[model samples]
Target chain A: MKKILKFIKYMMTYSLLILLAVFFTFPFLWILSTSFKGPENLFTWPPQFIPEHPTLENYVNVFKRIPMARYFLNTVIITSLGVVFQVFFASLAAYPLARLRWKGRDLVFKLILLPLLIPMQGALIVNFITIVRFGLYNTYIAVVLPSAVSVFGIFLMRQHYLSVPPEIEDAARIDGCNEFQVFWKITFPLVRPAAMALAIFAFTAHWNSFLWPLIVLRDETRYPLQVGLAQLNSVFEANFRSVAAALVLTMVPILIFFYFTQRYFIEGYKGAVIK
Target chain B: MLSRKAQVYLIAFSFLIAPLTLLAIFTYYPIIRGVVLSFTDYNMMLGKAKWVGFRNYIELFKDEEFYVALKNILRYLIVVPFIQFFSILLAVLVNKRLPGIRFFRTLFYVPVITGAVVVSITWRWIFHIDGILNGLLLHMGLIKEPIAWLSDPRYALCAAMFVTFWRGLGYYMVIYLAGLQNIPSELYEAARIDGASSRQIFIRITLPLLKPTILFCFLISTLAALKIFEEVFLLTQGGAETTTMMYLIYDYAFNRYEFGTSAALSVVFSGILLMFTVINFKFFRAGSEGR
Candidate 1:
């Protein structure tokens, strides 16, 4: 009787979990279905669960109606450039703070924390002023430079680096490997997981970046995907199918990128946001 | 070779201290600029900002939209936590470590990362007169008429809050999971050994231990809710005059070309966020030290 009760409870628990998972996963499945459904089939009375007729027409219309190509290119350029520069600067800066014995090191790390308190929006207020003052407004460099040294990246890398054994650095020094060589040859490889974490961090941030581009980029041609999509949203009226298509296009890269690097992204999310 | 002490000093100067001069110029400068700009009659677009001494803030004091947005925000700040706490309770049920629980976890997290725009769009469709929600409700004989969720001022804010809750719960659940993992099972085992009831163990062990994570979730949620932009913009467009401060500020800065006022509102906005940041730091610091 006890064994039977245990089995019943086990079955009940699994059944509830499966139901909960399906509930959470519903929105994504709906969006995917909506994106693929025929124009007429999309707004049906019952809302077609499966596409009665799936067509690529909405996607084709997305390209033709809007500069989807330009938006895609802009997204590629800014995210690619921003991620590369952000990681390089963050790690380069993190190297000394993590491993080196520096004066006022604790104070400096605390100061970096202050910037983390200052959200990207706060920085945007100043960054906009700086960009215009330097005549770099709407320039690609303008978009990338201000955000290059992410404090979170610096902090996370510093955490991982401080855990390295002291003996490795001492051995490198005995082999005539100077600090730069020690960092490049010995330390960098040791902190690969953290670096991977930072790369994914920078990529997602730059990809979803909307408010910054909205403020700085003026030319319609120059707008990144989020900003471009927002503009597309403003200019159109009843192209719901195409609007849905554009959204699907915008989300595809993120979904694909997340799928490929999800484990790391998950790891980074766990590390960065401690509830 | 120089002694380790000397090397440490050199590294500190080069790596940590040197980079800060740039940060001082960039991060600190803008904050000061914002404070100064808030008091001035600054315009948005032209960039020829001149100080007018408290006029912009004074004008802000009189703005009707500002009050509405503030009231809307405060309502969320006060009420959303209870809503979220309940949702999290629901999530914990789903998060039970039973068979197929991992599948449930994935389900909860899927909406968390999906863009805000898509979620808002989905919800907007559902709340339409002929949409699934109304259809389901009517089929269940819950409502006499299809409610005008988005169009009615009475329901618009409530409708937006529903979307916010739906979009946000999954993200917090994951955070809760992280906090949950930190708890050692031995505590529960000990409680069980002592013949402590399930509710007694939960109240004593889980709630107290989860306080820090709960605080963290609260802080982020409060701040994010204050700056809830994408959903409001997509769904309501600040409809029925239910504009958020961020949306209003975005309008002033980008649309109306009131950079000075925009900067002022931003200064005010960050001041609010900074207050919460201080609270979070205190909570986390105390919690960490307690351990």
Candidate 2:
């Protein structure tokens, strides 16, 4: 009787898990099915889980209707530039704030974190004007420049840097290493996993960023995938299959990227929130 | 040769120069400039500003859409408690050492990872007049007529809030899961040995332990709801009485080219956000002290 009860409880748990899983993923699955469905009726009485006649025609049509490849290239360029700048600037900026004992260090750090308390939503317009004034409008740099030095990135990196022991750095200094060498050879290497976590965070953020790219990029060819997909959404409003295919194309790369680096995401959040 | 003190200063300066300059230009300058711009008539073509004190603020106070946007955003906060409650439950469910748990976690997070544009567009299709939701409801005899979910003012904001709630679940679930993992298993073990029920364990141990994570999520989700834009922009185009403050700001500056008015709206919106943040901090402090 105890064994039967255990089996019943096990079945209940699995059933609940499966039910919730379907609830979360059914939309994407429906879109996937829709993308593959050939010219058949989409709004059936019971709804079709599987396509009756699957085809690659919608995928082909998405490419033809929009410059999907160019958008992907733009997104790649923008995302890489953003990721590099965010990680590089964050890693460098955090070093002084964390490792160095200098005048006004605490003051500087507090000032940096002040924006988190008082967010400047007005930056949306002012930054646009700044971008245009600097002749960066319609360029990829315009999209990446304003957000290049993230305050949260600096904070995250600094938290990681502070956890590095001072003895290692002192030993390097005693061995006749200069401050730069101590940072380069001893301290920087110690915090590489933190840097990796920051980079992964930066990657996802830049990959999905939309509104700024939309405001800054004027030329159609300069549009990132998010902006491009949004435009495709409007253009293909009635054409569900084409829109579904375009969305799939846009989502697959990020989804695959997440699948591999998901561990960093969880670990990164753990470090960030648990502190 | 420089002394060690000088060398340290030089290193710090060199490391900070680029990031600091960028921050000053992008972050700090904007705060001051945005306020200044709010009082002036900004000309994009001429690249000039003419001071017109109180006019922009006066016009903003007179706008009906502004209040609608404000009301919609406050109404959007209804999703926060639902998201937090469900996500904590989800975290507990998946926290178990079950088979295929990793797959389920990934599946749940698919909506969040896919980004807002994809998620919004997918839902836009699903919320269409003849969409799957309507068809399913009709087949189940839930409704006699196919309701225009996105076009009708009554249902449009609700639909947008639903998408936000759905996409947000997995994101917060992951965070809550991390919070749950931080709780030592010994507490659960101790409770079990005392013959405590699962409900008692959760209420006494889990709820109190997850306080910090809960507070953090509340602060962020509240702010996110206030600044909501993409879903409204994509789904209803801010029609059907669904305009949010962020969308209003975007539309004013970008579409209408009313830079001064947009700046005014932004200032007001920031003030609202700052007020909420202060309230949250106060609540957090009070909760911690009471504990």
Candidate 3:
């Protein structure tokens, strides 16, 4: 009797879970279906959950209509540079604050965390002025530089570093390894998981960063994937199929990256939030 | 080689220099400049900054749009708890040790990484008068005529809020899942030994243990809601009743070229955000302690 009851409960839970999953995933599936559907297949009275006649013409039009390749390259450059520099600098900054015992370290860490309260969005006006004043207007660096040093990255690394045992560092130091050697050879390697997590976070963030890029870049040639796709809405005002195709095109790389790194992503997300 | 103490400081400062310098130039300096710019009539095109003593503030106080934007943000607080409930529910449902759960997790998380632009565009299509939402509703006999989800003033803000809720639900689910995992299994076993029902255990153990995570979710979600701009820009274009504080600031600075007014508006906006942060911290802390 108890086994039957347990089985019933399990079935009920699984059904609910499956229902919610479908609801959550239906939009992406819709885009996928819409992107492949022929022009006639769209705008039916009741939308087809699956495309009756699939074609690649929408995707072909997407590449032909917009500078898809350049936008991809631009996004790659910004996301790669953004991830590398953000992780490198954040790890470096987290070291002293996390591992070493220094005077005013706590105060300095507190100062760095002060930006958490002030929304960076609110400071857009000043940042816009600052960027223009520096003569970096309409450049990729203008979009990438402000975000290259993330307080969240620093905070994440520091938390990871705090979990490292200190005796290992002491052992490295006693073996005549200098502080840099200890960090480079021992401490840094131990925190690779945290760094990997931070890298994923930084990569997806920079890849999808739109608002700052939207404001900072005026030159159409320099726009990243999101901004370029946003501009396509105006250029392809009535062509929802092609716009859907372009959306899928821009989304594929990030989704692929997420698929491969989702383990680290979830673990990293858990670490950051739970801590 | 330098003395050990000197070497320590050097290594520390070297690591700290690049990020600190960048933060100072981009973050701290801009913050100070934002405050200073709020006090002056600084036009970006005119390149002239004149001291205007609280004139911007006086005008802002009398501005109807500012009040409306503030109220919109206050009302948008509905998303915070709405997301929290859904996130926790999803997290609990998926927290089980079951087969094929990873696929579900990944599926749920897809919307989060879809980026704001994609989310806005996808939802814009869905909410169109002839879009899937209306088409589905009409088929279900919920309404006779197609509804303008994005254009109608009554539904515009609600539509934008729904988009936010949809995009954020998955992201916050991951957060709560982490919190759920941290609750040791021994508690559940002990409760079961005491002949506790599942509902009783959930209320007596899960909710109490999940307080901190709930607080964190509330903080981040509230902050995100308060700074909502991308959705407004993409979906409604800040039309009708959808203007938010962030959108208003963007309009004042970029559209009108009123940098001083934008700066002043930002300062006021930042003040409200700061107050909320403090209040949230206090209330959550008090709630936790009382528990």
Residue B125, candidate 1: alpha-carbon lDDT: 66
lDDT of 1 by residue, B208-251 (tens): 88777787787778888888777777778888656888888888
Chain A accuracy of model 3 expressed as TM-score: 0.92
Candidate with more favorable, higher DockQ: 1 or 3: 3
Question: The CA-based lDDT of model 1 is what?
Answer: 0.74
Give candidate 2's error at residue A223 in angstroms.
0.9
Alpha carbon lDDT of each predicted model: 0.74, 0.92, 0.88
Q: What iRMS does model 1 reach? A: 3.2
State candidate 3's DockQ. Answer: 0.67
lDDT of 2 by residue, A1-275 (tens): 99999999999999999999999999999999999999999999788978999999999999888999999999999999999999889888999999999898999999988888897899999999999999999999999999999899899889989999999999998999987788888887988887887787788888889999999998899999999988985677689999999988998898998899888888878877877
Best by DockQ: 2
TM-score of candidate 2 versus the correct structure, residues matched by position: 0.98
Tens digits of lDDT, candidate 2, B203-224: 9999999998999999999999
Better of 1 and 2 by DockQ: 2
Instruction: Flag regions of model 1 displaced more than 4 Å.
Output: A39-45, A117-122, A273-275, B1-22, B43-46, B78-102, B188-200, B285-291
Chain A agreement with the truth for model 1, given as TM-score: 0.87
Report fnat for all candidates as fractions from 0 to 1.
0.36, 0.87, 0.60
lDDT of 3 at A191: 91
> Tens digits of per-residue lDDT for model 1 on A95-198?
88778765677776887878777753445566677788889889777787777777778888888888889899889989999787898899988988788878
Residue B186: error of model 2 in Å?
A: 2.2
The candidate that wins on TM-score is: 2
